[model samples]
Target: MEKLAASSLPMPTTIIADAGFDSEENYVYAVGDEKEPRFEFLIPYGTSVQEQTRKYKKDIQNAKNWTYCEEEDCFLQLKI
Candidate 1:
């Protein structure tokens, strides 16, 4: 992350990553204050009550709304 921040390449406004890099420390680093370059990160949290609830899962699956990625061969059910 530090290397990327220091690199000459253009930085993106947003970043998406798997659960492995999901943590408070990383969040703080990626989303710094106004003095720093801000980045909006999309990282899924670990399993929790919301994810375990039957109603939540049912709603997500029943919504029939998903964003598919052909390259990754996956579907993302966006709530927003």
Candidate 2:
């Protein structure tokens, strides 16, 4: 980011990255703290995307089969 800001080239209007670059710090950096963002970004959460795949869904221990209890802020594995 420092390099990009210091460069003489024109600022890009948008940025696209794979799941590998997805992180809270990256998101905050791309979008400035102020009202307006520094640049637009398109990044998807890695886990969310993985969960939709057939391989991930077939796993019995997958989080998708577990229930998230907001009140307890924990995941509950209900017995069958």
RMSD of each: 12.1, 3.7
Cα displacement (angstroms), candidate 2, residue 9, comes to 0.3
Residues 1-80, candidate 2: write the lDDT tens digits.
67977999888889989999989999988888885789999988778787888877667687777889999999987643
Q: For candidate 2, what is the TM-score?
A: 0.62
TM-score of each: 0.53, 0.62
User: Which candidate tops TM-score?
Assistant: 2
Backbone clashes under 3 angstroms, per model: 0, 0
Clashing pairs in 2: none
User: Best by lDDT, which number?
Assistant: 2
